[model samples]
Target: MNLRRRLAWLPLAAFLAGFLPATPSLAAEPGSENMLAHRAAYRLKLDSVRDNASIEQAEGIMLFEVIDACDAWASRQRFTLLVGDRDGNIVETTSDYATLEAKDGSSLRFSLTQMTGGAVTSRVAGEASVTPQGGRIRYQEPAATEDELPPGTILPMIHTIRSLAAARAGQRIFVAPLFDGTSADGAQDTTTIISGGWLAPQPNANFPLLSTLSSARMRIAFFERNTTGQGGGAATPDYEVSLRYYENGVADELKMDFGEFVVDGRLGELQTIPSPC
Candidate 1:
């Protein structure tokens, strides 16, 4: 299954907002007023993805909103995802609602809502049983079969930002991308990276205001190669992934332009999740 298809379990609209510009940093400087009041929203535009076999193009729209924030303590977020094709016809759309609160040391309570299709169907709802080691997020729910409930929903994009904030600059951290289990393909289509670079401080802005603060250019791509089974395997590919955080790192605006993919011989998938206007 493709990355976007696997991500379909959760609301696709929310993740697209990660492409927007970065927000001002809420961390206060020495002797400076505590201007790090936490709260932010982001709007983003969905890009196009080409299907190699069908030669079809898919377009989408995404919105992300940070309902609550207390820096490293806790946060609440919501997202909406919509997808279409070259002719501007609606393909599929849904929404995902989530909340993250710090539990014990290095642990958190993760919860989510599953919305499917354009009609906003309520598939299932659940929380994580136990936090993964090293602050990693490890939660799963069964497939949305007629007999069983939908898999444990997750917000991979928000978890990425949370992982970033939990660590100090120059420190390396491993973030487990959101996985619904049902979409795990034989090719091991997962990507990982070590990102820790300079970020400009965000300017002073009135709380709950929408604005572009800072921008950073970074690299994101797949690492390990698949070699065990059939099909092309074992050659890692590289690409450029740029991300912009808004509202003082409470939200993100991301842009990932994969020049090409090796195994599939097709372009990478790009989508946007924006906040409600």
Candidate 2:
């Protein structure tokens, strides 16, 4: 049912002017030239569990890192989820997911490996290219599968840029196709609802990490694309995520809702990495 893939969602770091204009160091994207690089850790805890949710108790640690690779943005998310089943047994699952996207937003490469009870459960590797008409992905793990993305679609990193850009431009809502390699379902249509507004510097202990940055609240909903409009407006979303996105692309205060249950992740630690142009 691609359960593990569904668990692989996102959570970013970096400056206010980083998106204002493209500089040699700050090339206007997360992984561009001299963009913000940082490592962040979060503590995940169960929020609300529905009657159908098999998860009884969920607690884990999530570590995320973003590196600027000159022409590409390199990102990795290492998560360990401890799940308590109804049978009074606990299973520890770990997922290591990484991706590299070109700064020009033309291509993306992704790898995901999931281990349950210290055993590998799934591995998915793929690459996708964006074009004027749409995009295509070539998967290499589990089984080779090819999928198509519609026109006006955007990848993960580019989605971050565009969302932040929209917030800066006073735009409230945006709909786009996103391919994060988290699922075999290829590209999912996403609608981003943006709120909040730019604010002056804050008294954050993280200093440049959060104090000097502008921020906005964003809720992104994912849905299966409907080529046939027969479903009409009653279609429900597959999943939904809401977080605070920084001007520099870093996100925290994550709440992931899977309909039956909810998981909350709070930032525990954050460190900015020096960027080299």
Candidate 3:
């Protein structure tokens, strides 16, 4: 099963929180020209596992293009991911577009297109509530019938990136685990996610057109395992996610390491869009 399927069998609260920030500094306000330079295209390789055993693993190459960005909001960002399996075979792919609106808090609207077996099989749309400390996000797959998703569903990693961009420096944020209390068969699996931190700004490089940058390093722990049917004993797994953002608070790099599995991705490949006024 995929990441989303595994998480679907868990609990609803798993959607709560994820990611953090850094120490205080007189940095350029979020979304400055200095940070924009860091924005460019990159590739990723991910290893995924359960109970310390390899379940599914893939290497993904992605192109992230910045559509538009202003002091008030960033709009028109696009991402495409081509994923390959352990045997170096292309197994699945995803493409998505996002628009961010900055209010008292931030908000993001994004849609994902999933391709498998050389066909587009599913599309997902979701929104997230963004805050200075952390945020909450919820998504639904139109291909699925019920309002709630099943356990073990590895939802896309995009929401995690959105949450990090919304976080301010020196604040705590919680991301609900991937599993929302219901399984594919409608069973409840309880799990919790604890997260906290702030955005740390990085100095500008030789590139003058780029803006300053900031990053958040997060630690995640999964409590209470439900291994009743899998035959394996219950085990608590720990994970680490490191996120890097540019153009003030837009995501540019995302790295997730679950000890057993690791995913490293970068955003690039710019396309012009109507600038937010």
Best candidate according to TM-score: 2
- Going through the candidates in order, what is the number of backbone clashes in each? 28, 3, 57
Comparison by lDDT, 1 against 3, better one: 3
C-alpha lDDT score of every prediction, in listed order = 0.33, 0.73, 0.38
Top lDDT prediction, candidate number: 2
Per-residue lDDT tens digits for candidate 3, residues 163-191, read 44445434454434232222222212222
Q: Which regions of candidate 3 fall more than 4 Å away from where they truly are?
A: 3-39, 46-57, 65-89, 99-110, 126-169, 172-215, 219-240, 257-260, 267-276
RMSD of 1: 10.8
What is candidate 3's TM-score against the reference? 0.47
- Model 1 residue runs over 4 Å out of place are 1-39, 51-76, 103-111, 114-116, 119-124, 129-168, 171-196, 202-242, 246-248, 256-277
Model 2 lDDT per residue over 1-277, tens place: 2348656767332111122222122244443332467888989998988887777787888898887766667778888878786788888888888887767767777778888889888887777887768879899876798988777667787887878778778888977877787766687778888877554556676445687777888888888875653321126888888888777777768887867667798888888877664
Query: What's the residue-level lDDT of 269 in candidate 3?
Result: 46
Per-model TM values vs. the true structure: 0.45, 0.85, 0.47
Candidate order (lDDT) = 2, 3, 1
Please write out the lDDT profile of model 1 over residues 2-76, one tens digit for every residue.
Answer: 233322222111211222222233452221121122333444344434345321333343333332222222333
Name the candidate, 1 or 3, with the larger TM-score value: 3
